[model samples]
Target: MIGEFAKRQGVKKVYGIVSDYQVGRDMWASLKADMESKGIAIAGIDFTPIGTKDYAILLDKAMKSGADGLALIVVGGDTVTSLKQGGDVGLASKMKVMGTMLMDETQGQSVGAGGALGVHSTLRYHFTQDTPRNKRFVAAYRAKYGELPSQYAGEAYDGMSWWLDVVESTGVWDKEKWVDAFRNSVRNDSVEGAKRMRACDNQAEQVGLFGTAVAGGAGQPPVTMKVTETFTAQDLFKPCQ
Candidate 1:
């Protein structure tokens, strides 16, 4: 989706940050291949070694690389650190920024006020989405966890629950049968607002919310986004042909 968005926007070059970890390296390679196949060029690639505490220098290199956009794929503590430093260096204003599913409200707060505002990325769900399944999921999650669930938690919960449901219903771990059943399942009953899960990619497709970072209420922390619109999976994703 990121590649398609960049391509559609006439961006000739894309920049990305990857961690030195195995998974991060692998994902970066995949994204590079995808972008190249679409005729987009990778302007620059920066790999920050794992456990690197200071990102000021790294951000400097990335910003000076002359790329038009930035995609941050690192997660958890590393993501927070990068956002803080990225904001400090005015990277967001200088370049279009997008993040992975891990860029949540908590991380947005660290980016400071208006840091990630208007930054667009794909997601499985958002707290502001309205749906019966979502309502039930939210209610149940708060009831169980004593707090509101983020998209990550909701997606994880839904994926695991769906898998469990299939396993229990079929009473066997037949991988092929489970795979087929999952592909054909129209799981409108998701707590994460997913309409269905694609067994082929093992990814759930659903309406995604786009949001901008905004100041939280008085005396509250910064928020990641103010809901802009509900985008269908098909709308956000362009089929590769």
Candidate 2:
């Protein structure tokens, strides 16, 4: 999706850097295949093992790849360390960077302002979502938990809401009725926006977001992820179930 996003931005080529885990390898492979179909060549690819520290060689190759964009497929502490090192080496100015498992507040703080600026990420939720339902949920969550809600919180709320609605309308929570209720309902007023559980796959079809990480001032987390695009349910690609 990041490659597709880059192509939409008119980027013709990109380098892919992923960690040496099976998950990272699979992600890069998928990206390479997708970009090829779109006429966007992957200029180069590399993998970093877990706990690997130095990125100077990888950064050098990335700068030399002549690609104007990058696909990063690493997670957790590696995400922070690599972004910081990539920034230190001027990779951000030289290329448009996109990645998985990013735009997190904790990672942003570790990456800092200079390191995180211009990094783009796609994610399921962000606490700063401006929709009215989201705003109310965030306010209530903060009041109760003394912290911003995560995607887990959103998932819990959506799950319970769906069941409650089902129980209210039918007054029978039998297996057949429960399944029917979920499949038939359209939850337009969800905190995350309009959603419908796909009858074919039983997955909630809702909006995903693309965001840029920016520095937040005092009293807030060190970094704040702000949404730039709201990808509708129909915009998501679903496979045969």
Candidate 3:
């Protein structure tokens, strides 16, 4: 999603800042592959140790890289710190910034709408998803928990719901039977939209959502996510190897 969006935005070059770890290394590699496949130059890449608060040097390096896009591939508290400091240095303003999991409801609230505005990322589930099912899910979640659901919470609910449905409908109590049922299930009514289990790899194939942080409208929360584009499962998922 980040690579495609960057290409559309006419970004010919990009710089990346990622965590110095296995997951972050994999993410950086994926981003690099995607961008290079689209003919975008990788001006520079930096891997910062997790929990590194000061981004003066890294941010300065990115600024001087002559890149039109920045890929941020950090998570957890690192996400908050990098984004806050990135804002201070006007990085987002200077380049098109893309994140792996940036500015969701929790992070957006922490960064505030001002800091998160215009930042884009690919999301599987977001509270701002506008649909009757998602609206009900969000409302029920907020009513019960006093807060919106994140992607983690949403996936848990969906997975649990599928399990129960399979058990009830098939009257299967065997663990293997349950697993098989799940492997064959197709959930068209998920809060995040339609998804189906790819039995070959047991991977869930679902729609991909590209979202951006935008200030809330009237009666909305201080920070809200706006889905700018939606990718079909076919457009997103790779074939099972």
Give the TM-scores of the predictions, in the order they appear. Answer: 0.75, 0.85, 0.91
lDDT of 2 by residue, 1-241 (tens): 5756777778899998889999889888888988888899889999889776887788789889899888877877778788899888766778888886565665677888777877888867777776788899999999998888765687688678877887688887587887888887788778887788778877888887777777766656767776777777666656546
**What would the per-residue lDDT of candidate 3 be over residues 1-241, giving only the tens digit for each residue?**
7887787778999999999999999988988999899999999999999989898788889989998888988878888888888888777788888887777666788986556877888776777766677889888998998866886687688778877887777786688888888899898777777779999999889878778888878755677778887878887778887
Top candidate on lDDT is: 3
Which 10 residues in a row give candidate 3 its minimum summed lDDT? 216-225
Over the full model, what C-alpha lDDT does candidate 1 score relative to the true structure?
Answer: 0.68
Give residue 97's lDDT in candidate 1 (0 to 100): 70
Q: List CA RMSD, all candidates.
A: 3.9, 2.7, 1.9
Q: What is the lDDT of residue 193 in candidate 1?
A: 54
Give the better candidate number (2 or 3) by lDDT: 3
Task: Report residue 64 deviation for candidate 3 (angstroms).
Answer: 1.2
> Against the hidden true structure, what lDDT does model 3 obtain?
0.82
lDDT of each: 0.68, 0.79, 0.82
The true-versus-predicted C-alpha distance at residue 76 of model 3, in Å, is 1.5
